[model samples]
Target: MSDASGERQSPAPFLRLVRGNPTPEEAAALVAVLTARARAVQAARDAEAAAPAPRSAWRAPSHPAGGHPPRGAGAWRRSFHPG
Candidate 1:
């Protein structure tokens, strides 16, 4: 199938499965399974959205350099770049 722009369409997995024209009983089972899976995904998403944000233990270091304090006058050569 094509879309309004006349580009070839990609069939979703359910549509591809339906193209085989399953028996009525098989079709009913497939629908039930798909519906259950969809509900499970929605429930998981809702749970995640309702969960509390994580608490952070990290705090900015007091060093004027913005991160860890310099070890010595030549520390810049060995130290990671601080923001």
Candidate 2:
């Protein structure tokens, strides 16, 4: 897991395999896969942030006053402001 910067990070198994004495090729492959996955995930997150958010069906309707209505009042309007 990298921070904001795009720096290389060591995988969990890399350290374990080092202590357990893994083969050189296996270690290299593990590192490659982990780094690729990290980059892919970061790219996906960046794309999502850049993309416009989809409209939500569950989103509250905009009020004429240009702000959200008081919470929990949508179902209680009739009782409080009887017609």
Q: Give the per-residue lDDT of model 2 (tens digit) for 1-83.
A: 76569777766653355266778898889889989999999999999999998877556465333334445557468545545
Q: What does the lDDT come to for candidate 2?
A: 0.71
Q: Show the colliding residue pairs in model 1.
A: none
Cα lDDT tens digits, model 1, 1-83, are 89999999878765346367689899889889889999999999999999998755463344334456579887886576653
Per-residue lDDT value at 54 in model 1? 79
Worst 10 residues of 2 by lDDT: 62-71
- With a 3 Å backbone cut-off (N, CA, C), the pairs that clash in candidate 2 are none
Number of colliding residue pairs in each model? 0, 0
